[model samples]
Target: MAACAYCGTTILFGGIKDDDLRFCNDECFENGYALVIARSVSDNVVKREANKIYNGACPKCQGIGPVDVHVSHRVYSVLLYSSWSSIPNICCRSCGLKSQASNALFSLFCGWWGFPYGLIMTPIQIVRNIFGMARPPEEFAPSEKLENLVRIDLATQYIEEKSMPPPVNDV
Candidate 1:
């Protein structure tokens, strides 16, 4: 008899699926084993579809643009210059707009990079960068208000970028 992987309940070995593996019982098999695998697969599909929707839309107009837009990832060196960062941006063949692929990614980067209020600093940094100011130092502290500001800026940028007309020349 094999023990349940999760609860360790003793059970007779049940037959396998295609992989020839054994399980303790139907409950343990379904809840402990199969559900985990299935959840991963479902998550992957959802992520792919979200990416498809994000990349397929026109970066400038947010409308469905030309079908030939290419999605690519690029690595950039941040302030430390030793560690490299990977950023996903989209290049449009129709509108010629090149910008970050997803707002969620921008949010994640801020959250992950030790910025307490990254959601706010990110767009401020972007706007400051656009206006020729040095981005706030990475170690700069952020507040809850800053986080809200960053989220608002990101939303506005998204809306503006999506509503603008596509480029005239077909790239």
Candidate 2:
């Protein structure tokens, strides 16, 4: 099994690129190569819909454009780097609480890698992740209208974005 070049996670189904590097998804590949992220087709659609919602009022503060956007990045174990044991989230910059939560969880399990960076960073991230999850800003908070088609689009975008090497057999 090849390991992901970005996070060092074992790649079970990802393909090899340039005859050497392997990544689970474009996210990892981009991270590995330090390339700009390539947004998939659905990402544009969600951005359009989300813009439509934010176009009106803030979900939390009822303010405007500078509002925060929440995106989830999965964390892999620094020690194991196995797909089976990812921490689910690495950080959410929009909310400080969620940042901490994700970090703390990672530190608890992967804090001993290559010195003490994990120990130093995990606690901070955990607090942020949990706090963000628990008390998102008014603008970031979920709204009743958020549960409709907008949500479906976002979910679809996430699923599609994560599906490395898009499927050829479109149905």
Return the TM-score for each candidate structure.
Answer: 0.21, 0.29
Residue by residue across 1-171, what tens digits does model 2's lDDT show?
A: 788877888888845574577887877775555321222224444455555654554454454432334432233345533222223221123333344455546555664453344444445554555555665434653333333335454445445566432322322
For candidate 1, the 10 contiguous residues with the lowest summed lDDT are: 132-141
lDDT of each: 0.37, 0.46
lDDT of candidate 2 vs native? Answer: 0.46
What are the per-residue Cα lDDT tens digits for candidate 1 across 1-171?
655664666656453332444456565555445333333233333333334534466655676633222322222223423222333223233332233333324433533343333434455444432332122212222223323333333334434465422232322
Tell me, by TM-score, which candidate is best: 2
Position 148, candidate 1: lDDT? 32
